[model samples]
Target chain A: MAMERHERFSLPKVWKPRNVGEAWSLKRSFGSDAEYVAGGTLLRTWWEGEVAERPAHLIDIRSLPLLAGIRIAEEGGTGIGACTTLAEIRRSCGLAAEYPALPEAVLQIGAYSIRNVGTIGGNVASGIGDALPALLVYDAELLWFDGSEERIAISEWLERPEDCRRDRGKLLMQVRLPDRANAVETPTGGGNAPFSVYRKVGRREAFTPSVATVAISAGRTEDGRLERVRIAAGGGAAVPHRLYAAESLLEGKTPDPDLLPLIHEAVEETFRPKGDVFAGEEYRKRTAANLVAAELWKLSAGRQGKE
Target chain B: MIDNRTELAPAQSRLTLRVNGAACEIAAPPSTRLLQVIREFIGLTGTKRSCEIGRCGACMVLVDGEPVNACLAMAYQVQGAEITTIEGIASGTELHPVQRAFLEEGGFQCGYCTPGMVLSVKALLDRSPDPSDEEVEEALSGNLCRCTGYGGIRRAVRRAIELGR
Candidate 1:
């Protein structure tokens, strides 16, 4: 009879590869026994008992060539490599112009050094904090390279809480952003194009995680009517999601002073926040609602003035 | 106690680094963090370690002309890479433009965060040459100075940009 040995509290063996091909080779060799580590920011937290069991083997994937750029796709959207650092994303010229909200969210993710080490893949895989809101607003898709296959989608990758806790084998490979026109284009005839605004209520200005974060883009028609609007919020919800109801209510509506209450109500229905150390449910709810109204108002005003 | 004279075998993962215009090699563990190998093995103590986690930019070093946190990077990852620490920022006795700006603008009080801050400024100037105030702030946002010397740091970055131009 063979004996199964369970070593308690053993530090996982670490493997450092020179590039992505070597990383993939290691991933195939170890199968599910290995976990790819880019920055190790999240892994250390788990090691210190802040989370669950660490994978038995750490496969370092920072040197992978495919996962290190923010470039415009031939099809017109932005293509951010999986291992591209938040610092790199924040500094990318094309991303800064096309997806302003993304850079803003990246800037707010951690202190400078964390940005230097933390990768876009890590941010999306963790499925916490600013990444969700930022990507959701941009209608970003996750590209996964399983040992034997590749898959891509916005809705298919993330599970809905119940399914996620049951199993965890999905490794996020890359994030593919949709074209800018698809992301920010309006239905009605455009006057001046809309701009994105990202707002987060955190405990402090820097180094603290967000209590609630919101990213919104609103465009207006030539006649001062709302053309299109997109809203995504995180940190207060079980999973970060788009405020579809709020978005539906906002589109085609003129933002008069009285519109604020209706906008607030629509956004409030989208999220039911729970209390934590950073902020209570009531405060988050109020702030989230207010931020939507304020940002929408500003966008509408700016569009109206330009028209 | 057991005989303490057993010569410990050196963990040998070859690291090829072009550091400060000089090529150097060191044998270390593949898992050894670049910060550890640099400070302990190579004996370059200019880069400080704080938090060890990526949250603090205290151990920042320039890897291939980009600023990266050394604590989060393995030494093996830096093979065939160009690295510049705070020690390599000057030529002989003369200070780099960034260093000169830091000195003239009083960029450090506690001095713990200076190395990372300087490296970050060097990286920004290497790319942008003349970055806006917001860009400078964004670049240095990763570094945390406990003495709240941001005003002077900002001035130093701006001065370095001017001097570089």
Candidate 2:
């Protein structure tokens, strides 16, 4: 039988941890030999693609009630558990309506089957998840259980050096999307009317790694001046970050087509994207810049018609 | 390779899975994947194994009525869930509408990708009886077919919707 053949890489020992504390202790004990697995779809990809070594132990944390379900606040906003699958988020009509780009990005991440097994927490933690850019625009924060519960902004955590976080033994408890995340397309069309967008250019229409991904969110004052403008770039191997230089240029100013060239230059200068065999560094930078530039131009042109 | 038994011995675990409306008790290593248990242990080869990674939906199965990648999921992880593979998709001996539609529409050529495709189509039809062309394309995106150029698959899906209605 094929299974009779000697296998070089032995399968890892599975550990079902009942709670976050147990999961954390297992990781701490096993050190590099262990991995905390929720859906494990992302980890499989990493191991198969040679991006990382296969761990000798997998601590299944999916059964932990502390890391389950989406809680929509009666007042506003939503708190999504770390183990919530991508499909679960997509099926959430209220979540999809509130943060349109999040579900849109989730739908485009992979096919239905992939989404069914992949968790949003794994995606965010992987640091290369396509959802990062959209989540960045929404100003999302993560609650982590590292010894005790520690809540921190996603942007702040992303800014920390990766080496420092590698052995931190922090378990992501849940992600909180504040009420302001619902600032997408209000009919009032007055001061503080917001518009948000997420664009991902992949090698194919679907089921491919991103070439360059960008997300933008801004509100216009009564006179159409940009307010609270946020721009982010990520996807592929790129570590997502806010494009503050480009954002500052568009902020407190009307999104004019004329300023797009300057904003394009700002993105090119700010974002340092990684390159793989499929795309080059320059190509990703250009693509990322162009995507945001084009989106800004569209917003500007729409106002042009109104004028 | 020299110490295979020593490495594989300690990881064994017993799992009970509800598959095809039957209860299956499997004693295997915790390292065993759900696809391996389904095909090797249960002897149900209807779920095709292509890309072991989640990239290919060739090993697609309905876990609690949701389409999931069998290859990506571990046997121990899905022990308590109800699993439905392509073999269990039909209502007994009678050919399922999805299977019949694919047969009439000639949705496959090499026949290697048929089982996965049929299951994927069944998943779509079961959820949304009348799915849009875009939704159909989206659902089948994970399952790759090297034959029929997807034109026949698209036709089969439409026919399945009609037969379902």
Candidate 3:
């Protein structure tokens, strides 16, 4: 099974810390040269051998027990450790049932192998990650430890990403989904669960960066009105965001065919998708609006089916 | 050859791993990529190195039974991991069933992508014995084959499933 060995060269130094506290201390000491790496899917691309800006110290945080595994809160929420791989999330049947959009978003990024090593924390930390929109719709929260432990809503973290960078000794601990168990699965009027849909239209059919992506969660009231609506978009290498205008358009209103056009218009008004070589601003704006409309239609369809 | 059990310091450390069922120890710098260690230090040329970026699946290997892009993994990440490469899939002078199926199905023309594709098929079959067409497509999506168009590879995946069962 052995093959003839080739010559080797000296690569940069890596530090392996056993726990979060030790890792944090290392981060504080190394400053810019030290970067914490879990899966290294995104970070490795930047700090290759002999690169001028290469990270001097690569901190392997995958082994730390503090940043591993998925834990379900006894009170009915889900907490995913920072090192939890996207493949783990994709294969999790429980998470899939509770938050379908999360698994759906994960499966569309890269492919099976990349997903295997790509951590959820890494994905969210990427800033323009595909999973952010879905997480926003699910009301996910980001848990991190700076000098002290702090937790913030994922929406807030997404708004100011640079502030959360680990370079400043602020390390991401885990992502928490609020306890949705007590929340009525079947609302008075329609839908079995909070119907959610995440759609990403990219340059290619699958396993490519999104040109436009949108995720939505909605439930109807006893009178067949839109009781609660949450809509978020932006995965196209553009700014990921929640569409408060679009969500406001549907909340507490009955599902009407005209609402589709209103939702699309609201999305266009809210988001200005940054254009790239693959797609221009107008095209991405149109696609984002279309995806948002499609999800609204899907949630409305689910309510109709229940009715 | 370095002793596999010789423990290095926790900070500046040597990598001790099982590569292709062999307990191997080698000097690994902190930032050394697994792809480099596999092809260079370990001398397993079966895992091709193309596009050092993680986007390309040319440098694919199985670490502890999970398929991951070797280009993206650090050498130390595989320190206690059971590493499997294209060379390790077969046992004692026999091609693994996936390789045989690829041969039967004409899964490749240029053969550059075959090693990664075959290992990916091995990982898929290890998990799902009877994978659906979409599942097969999803599993092999990371592996790009420009030569044979992928009709042959699709057939190879189906054939491998049958042969394994």
Candidate 4:
């Protein structure tokens, strides 16, 4: 763990802490010099991109008992250890069926091998991760350990990842997804079933950061009104945020194909996502809006198929 | 602007890595990439080193029966885990079915990305005997074959599935 020789570049000293207390103490002592790494996919890429420095001490917290595997809580909600890799999450059929948006977003993150090493926690911690919008729609809760423990909603943390990362020392422990298995208590049949979509439009088919990533989930009333509508958009350097205005507009409205244009307009107006040189700001907004509008129209189609 | 290839540093720990059904002892810092560990320490150069970043799947290997980008993982991190590389895939004289499929279908031209492509296909087939087109596409999406343009690789994957069946 004490290797400090720079042959080509400075490789960080890796510390394998056994427990949360040890991990915290090491972070406390090393301060900014130390970083808690799970998958290390994001950190490694950032280093290769020369955007960030390799920390002196990388506290490997992937093996910590508190942050290890996927668990089904007593209440039936899925509690995924922050250290769990995206690939591992994808393998869980139960979890995928429970929330397709999450697994769907996982598929769009990176290819299979990258997903194998990239942890969901690392994705969430990065904030700009493509998975953020999908997690947002699910109302994912992040459990963090900072001296003590605190549970914060993903929505709150996404607002200021840098500030949260700085203040909490990047100690994200678990992501708890609420049990939505029996959540559909609406008036009737398959029409009331929640429809969710996670779409990532990238420069290429894979690997690149998304041009505009969007996730939207909604349940419809028996009388045809949309309810519990959640809309989120993100990609590239843009901060992932909820489209509350678009959500409200879509809410209490029937899933008519004619409403697609208005919903699209509302999303385009609300999603103020940043864009890089490859894609302009307007393109990302429109792409996200189009994806959301198009995907939601499936509900209208689904209604027809049911009737 | 610092030169890193000047002087060597002291090796950190002697790790017993279980690679390809054999025990190989490697001594390096905790931060050494699995790519270096496999190539330099384990002496297996079959795993190509293109982009040191995890973007290119040239350095893919199976860790405990699951495919992962070797460049992204630290050697010490997977010390005890069972690591399988391209060199280990063949049964001595005979090549693995994935490798055979690549040859039969002309999966590669320059052959730089062949090892990784083969290993990725093997991983997929091992997990799923019958994978859908989407699954195959997703599994191979990380690997970049600049020469073959993936047409041959696609055929190779299909052929490999047939071979497995």
Q: Show where candidate 1 strays beyond 4 Å.
A: A1-33, A44-54, A62-78, A147-159, A162-167, A180-195, A218-228, A236-238, B1-12, B158-165
Each prediction's TM-score versus the true structure: 0.82, 0.92, 0.91, 0.92
Q: Mind giving the per-residue lDDT tens digits that candidate 2 earns over B1-165? A: 121222222335788879998998888676677888898889999888887887768888888887888878888778778999988977778899999999999988887778888888888888889888888988998988886788998888888999998
lDDT of each: 0.72, 0.82, 0.79, 0.82
- The per-model DockQ list reads 0.20, 0.41, 0.42, 0.38
DockQ of 4: 0.38
In candidate 4, the second chain superimposes onto the true chain B with a TM-score of: 0.90
Per-residue lDDT tens digits for candidate 1, residues A1-307, read 0001221234355675554545666666666677788776665545433365556667766666667787777876878888898888888877776777888788888766567677788777776657777788767887665544465455444445532331244455578887866344332324555557788887776667777888886555656566557787776434667888888887787766577788798888776566686688777777888888888777656556655
| Local lDDT at A230 for model 3 | 86
Worst 10 residues of 2 chain B by lDDT: B1-10
Poorest lDDT segment (10 consecutive residues) of candidate 1 chain A: A1-10
Clashes of 1: 1
What local lDDT does model 2 show for residue A165? 50
Better of 1 and 4 by DockQ: 4
Query: lDDT by residue for model 2 over A110-224, one digit each (tens)?
Result: 8888888889989888877899898898889888887788988888888875622535678888888888643656432334467777899998888888999998987677788
What are the runs in model 2 whose C-alpha is more than 4 Å off?
Answer: A1-9, A73-76, A163-167, A181-192, B1-12
DockQ class, candidate 2: acceptable
